[model samples]
Target: MATPLENGFSAPALRLHALDSEDLALLSAHVQDALVRVGDIAYLPAKRRFALVGSRFDWTAEMEGRLERCRAGLHFESVQRVRCARVSRDEPDAILELLAVTFEAGPEPPGGVIRLTFAGGAAICLDVECVEAQLCDIGPRWKTAARPTHELSSSESGAP
Candidate 1:
């Protein structure tokens, strides 16, 4: 329904054509006049610089750290268009946390993910083209509920 940027991240810098409401609300609450989130780090890949998102933002050694975390031999492919249910209470929140990190909305160690939560009393989990994460990267990040990510039909999931 609502988009990520439309909901809040509509700024000129980050082209958030679509935004999740929960993320928008969290960011909105934590934002300040200067726009430096206490712990949220943003890396401008083009400039090779890193800065906090909401206030007191500055170019720290953060971007370098983020760059280091990219998976070995990992190359950027097409972005995933995923949708899942919010089956478990914790699923949606977890998925959002991971998405934020991967999308440059949060810390870097949390990056590399593709997931969705289907919500309606019970939630289902769905993930497409994703990097190896979880177990190794653990925290409050959410996951799609009971439903495991459906694999792409041999054809659709592989290509752009």
Candidate 2:
């Protein structure tokens, strides 16, 4: 059954625990390919690796996204204070609530789910219903930039 969304859209099906370490590692290297800064806009150079910067679960997912964006040269605005988690099976109801609140809809719900494909082509679809509620559930954290594009200084990050 397709769930309701903010723009009347529906996300594709999601597969849980499909991403492996290699995939996550690649993704991590990509996201961190440029600069190691969170809560700010950064650019990822061509064919760079994503950065791995969080728990084994959510970080992998984020890294996967970074891989896609960097490899394809896609661009997006910076996310202010990110708190992520992979809730494929452990929290169905919570995910539903997230969809509702993230989209700002009441009992009926609001936004749709999004498909997130991993490095090896494994895809996971998630919804953002209660944006605020969902965000509250997460904690503040930092994600490194793509390795190759990372802006490092001798006195700052100890690299380059």
Candidate 3:
């Protein structure tokens, strides 16, 4: 069994990489409900990369009785193109709540569309040559009082 750190933290700052669908799924779960600003998103075509920085809620810490958030950076490499739907680059200060990251395979192997879904139907799609992505915690964690919640629809919740 692994022991907690001297400060009683169970884990160090997160640094994760995804080279395949399964790995991306795990990374997605860790970043669920992260808050991102529109201006923080960038696509560097010269570098074939798309990146963003956000405040990621620490779900792991929540389970340990500490609701906290920390700065995190996520980037995708080998990006071929980028698209946005219901998201405006004009509103640089607009905040988005990240809901999920999902992949839809293209006709060619290892090439696919990686979708970053946000609340309010906003989404960003990255056409990539392959699944090469990284997510890293970039700053100190600070306590927050609120934890994200989802409301299931009536049918899904067994309500008639």
The candidate maximizing TM-score is 3
Q: What does the lDDT read for residue 24 in candidate 2?
A: 29
Q: Whole-model Cα lDDT per candidate? A: 0.24, 0.25, 0.86
Winner by lDDT: 3
lDDT at residue 47 of model 1 (Cα atoms): 42
Clash pairs, model 3 backbone: none
Model 1: per-residue Cα lDDT over 1-160, one tens digit each: 2112222321112212123334433332221112212134323344432323222111121232211011011112223333334323343223211212223222433332332211122211222232322211111111111221233233322211
| Model 1 stretches with alpha carbons more than 4 Å out | 1-43, 47-147, 157-160
Clashes of 2: 38
Question: What does candidate 3's lDDT look like per residue over 33-144, in tens digits?
Answer: 9999999999999999999999999888888887778889999999999988877889999998888898889999889999998877778999999999999988767777
TM-score of each: 0.17, 0.20, 0.88
Compared with the true structure, what per-residue lDDT tens digits does model 2 show for residues 28-122?
A: 33333221112221223332212111112223435345321111121211112222333233332321111100111235343333222222222
